[model samples]
Target: MVQESFEFVVYMIHACATKWNRLPSFVYRKLAESGCIQKFLVPNYEILHTQSTDFVVSDIEEYLNVRKVAI
Candidate 1:
């Protein structure tokens, strides 16, 4: 039962992020806690084996839009 519940929560996170097309920072934390998103993300191309293809969207405050907590 516990495993089933955890799977459901992960699915919800992907659904909300992919279906809705946007997610808040706090939501991302919950998703990570539920094993939904990456536990550790490398922002730069410092990892030689992997290629960084992510495009960051930052506003005037110079913060990743996805990392901003909605209050």
Candidate 2:
């Protein structure tokens, strides 16, 4: 990943962790297992990284919800 995308991934991981009241590692695992990191976030980084953090977090939550992924 490019530097910016890498940073965004890290930021999103922490953001999700905080919003979900989970640890960063747990957030990372959930995202990875659900393919959110690779299939969603990173692929959409150009546009997504430009949005507000809450917006992105909401998007992530929606993605997981649609997939019926817990956490």
Candidate 3:
């Protein structure tokens, strides 16, 4: 089951945000805190303990900066 539309949306968003950088984190935190969005977003183990593709320390710092907070 390939999702071309979903992938296109993600890629377009990421590409446009590369210069802005903080957009993803804003989205991530909002999604992470919400039941519906979080279900489709990154999982807890990877977000908290692993530095895989999208959930790394740099990403955390970027996200914190957007919220004007730190971890």
Best by lDDT: 2
lDDT by residue (tens digit), candidate 2, 17-54: 99889999999998999999999999999999999999
Better of 2 and 3 by TM-score: 2
Candidate 1 wrong stretches, greater than 4 Å: 23-26, 30-71
Error in Å for residue 4 of model 2 = 1.2
RMSD to the hidden true structure, all candidates: 13.0, 0.6, 12.5
Give the poorly placed runs of model 3, Cα more than 4 Å off.
27-71
Per-residue CA lDDT of candidate 1, range 7-58, in tens? 5434444444554366645556654554323322222213411432222221
Candidate number of the best TM-score: 2
For each candidate, what TM-score against the reference?
A: 0.33, 0.96, 0.29
Error of 1 at 4 (Å): 0.3
Model 3, TM vs. native: 0.29
RMSD of 1: 13.0
Q: Each candidate's lDDT (Cα)?
A: 0.37, 0.95, 0.42
Task: Point out where model 2 deviates above 4 Å.
Answer: none
In candidate 1, position 27 carries an lDDT of: 51
lDDT string for model 3 (1-71, tens) is 13543453354335434634658665444434543123332333333333343443445446446656532
